[model samples]
Target: MIHDQSMQRRRSRIRGLFGVTAPTDAPADAHTPVEGERARLLDAIRDFLLGNNLDISAANLLAAHTAFSGGNPRLRRRIGERIAAGEAISQFWLDQQLRDDGKSDPATHYEDMAVRLQSSVERFRDTTSSARNAVVSYGRDIASQVETLAREEPAATSLLREKSQGMAETARTFEMRLLRAEREAQSLREELARARRDATIDPLTQLPNRRGFEAVFEEEFRMARSNVEAMCVAFCDIDRFKCINDSFGHDTGDRVIVAVGELLKTMGTGSCHAARHGGEEFVMIFRGFTTEQARERIDAMRIALGKRRFVQESTGDVIGKVSFSAGVADVFAFPDRRNALRAADEALYRAKEAGRDRVEIAG
Candidate 1:
């Protein structure tokens, strides 16, 4: 799985480095002068950056321009900030910003970013003006050839053109089906993967369910034991989840759960896995971290979630906010995974008994 992720990242980096190559029927030997055009484009972008006193490299500037032109504000802001800061372009920083922003406002952000890409397009347009003219010239040349051929061999020429047009249409239809099939296949694969994930996930919150957590817990525990390493478990429960469900509709309650789940997943990175143990309860396994580390991480997550205002999706109404109480414990103290889970649960119970929206660690 790590290898697959690494491979995908490597492939993405490679593609990013090369830029996207256009799919074409043209032979490799066909000299399209696109490489030269690209070089000129890069040079123009560098000149623009230098001319504008935007402290960005050519590649970075190009990426920013592309993102802006593609209408991504997140990217636009990122590029803008880096240039403003006089910092070197950082792909990682940009990516983290995007991830932090998450799935919300993708279209709006991208559209705003695309505006910045106009400069790149303008450069391309200028460079390709000659190419466009040449294309027109070629069209005239083809028209002259067709006329002469029609006069010399009217019947044969007419039949040939008709056959060519029919073949082209047939090819186009086939290509469209191929594209559709590819899209459908990709969708099915994603659905199948989702189903498999769902099997290991809690249906309500869609977090890794008890079964998934246990399996992962056992593996991490074993690794920790063998290495004489420290591991921690943090059990969390949404404060007043039942009350919220009772007050609001179950649908709204479900949305809250999903939002909380997302928050946990993001914040629980240091904690190996975040799982919906059952009901409003979530369990986080801090695989290779000490009790203190896990506690700090969970505390940070608790604070972040407690502060976030969750809005209702359907009507764009604010649905108030939510918070969780968590309990952290060392796995080494437990005889088994179940014992560790129980210890975390007890701590969580103590947290609820005292006050919610806080972290309580097992002594």
Candidate 2:
């Protein structure tokens, strides 16, 4: 009851700030401005999530709630622009935007987990080392005392020596166990590191997944900012991918995905860093390249890729020519990295609208 009353008081203050007031005798069901706005926002968010066929997952709910409630002006603006520009708010795109804005933790979560695990391993190793040292020291002290006892008391020699030897064996056994445990801990630490790396890479493409790409981009973006360098990021998507899958089956789709992955991997060998952005889309970044230069390079790649013919391995029948469309944005053109990607995505939408199998530069 106290919390509800406090919340009501806060609402009243907010309403007063917005030039709204409740009458002295207003009914409980009265629709105040703040209450009405909240109701409308709730309705709008529901309509949006359901209408777009987006999952009702926690992240989506939080993002939508924050966006609709005007908590994040940039996210709200970006979502509005994408809608206005005829872009679908796909799950992948939403996840990308969330990651770009640092709202999502999926990308760096593995690293965070690894850090904690590594710290634990280090602590365990330290504890084991201390225990091992203590046992060894204890065993040496026992042996030294037993030898002195043997020298001083010849009659008690047999019993003292036996007890000392038993203690020495126990200490050795414990030390060996500790050593084995420490080795296992070290192996676990290495495995954790590998797990972190694996999490960031796409299994299908052996390319950096969205999270890994972000990690690379973050470093590059930071350096580009510090040195004031030219950089470009492009989004590449297969043209008529759905039609291909429907016509030829999903096996063909997987093959197409792999084929694109191989090309992007090859491109990654150059100055451009490439990644499979998810689904039929890939992302690439080029340093020391103007937006125009990047667009030309991407266009040439597209043309060359279009020239290649894809044949089904099993059927040996030629699948129709596979092609891709791309959108390039100058990293420096926008104030931040996310906006640049959004601009690139918008240009990609325009390219699709114009016709696929081409490259478009962001304005």
Candidate 3:
């Protein structure tokens, strides 16, 4: 009851501040000034609502509520008076939303998703390691028992032969167990490795998916966050990919994607990780280099991709050439990979917006 009363009191005060007095037995003309004030408040509210982020909106709303509660005694008195007169407060300022500024972009989503995938891979790794450990422990115990039996029964020749055969069987059993353990370990390693790779990489392009790029970004972020190491992240997408897909079949389009992936992988050989971020989008991370340096290096790859001739395997028809737009961000200045990822993404958007097949760096 107390909570409801408090909330009711709060709502009344909000309405009064908005110049909404209780509709009462008093003359209708009594609300003329209040109606005028309400119009002005609404105008101010609209202006405020137009330019707020969620955080700012929340802060301002709380401030408005607090001011309504304590700052205007007339408003407070009117609120109490309205409640006594049984007026219902109907309006609230909580539903307003500012425009989405896109602070949480696709790259951010990918990074979070990749982390979860990697954790699952790690669990697989740990489980496999435990199994290997158990196998080794059992093998060691059997080997110890076989050795002790051989040493204690050295004189009984036939018995000794039986012991020898027993020891050989034990050794073979141990070898088989060890071999199984090794194979299982290898399989587990491969499965976990594949899982980890799949988490971040696009299967088609073999490039880092958004998830993969995010992992690289985070690693770079941690590296930068810890030390003075520099990193560069680049966001790229095939130019006119949709047009190519539309003109040609999806199979040819897929071939182009695969070709680009192969070229990018070969081109990004040392200290660079490249991935298919999403759709036709690709991301690359270059370690130990300035954005300028990385740009120069990647520019060559861009040109190579642009100039490369791709023929439609079906008709042996020339598919013309492919090109890409790229945006590069450096960790030297930004330091945070998340910020760098965002920067690169924004730059890539700008590059695409300006013109295709060009490189743009984050300012």
Q: Which structure among the candidates has the greatest lDDT?
A: 2
- Candidate 2 lDDT tens digits, 31-83: 67557555645654665576566899999998887665633333554565566
Task: Give a tens-digit lDDT track for model 1, residues 40-66.
Answer: 335434433443334575545655454
Candidate 3 regions off by >4 Å?
A: 1-199, 224-227
Query: Judged by lDDT against the true structure, how good is candidate 1?
Result: 0.61
Residue-wise C-alpha lDDT for candidate 3, range 25-77, written one tens digit per residue? 22233356556544534433332233222234564554334223222211223
Q: Lowest-lDDT window of 10 residues in candidate 3?
A: 96-105
Please give the range of 10 consecutive residues that has the lowest summed lDDT in model 1. Answer: 18-27
Superposed model 1: Cα runs more than 4 Å off: 1-198, 203-205, 268-271, 312-318
Q: Order the candidates by lDDT, highest first.
A: 2, 1, 3
Lowest lDDT sum, 10 consecutive residues, model 2, at 17-26
Please, what is the TM-score per model?
0.45, 0.70, 0.50
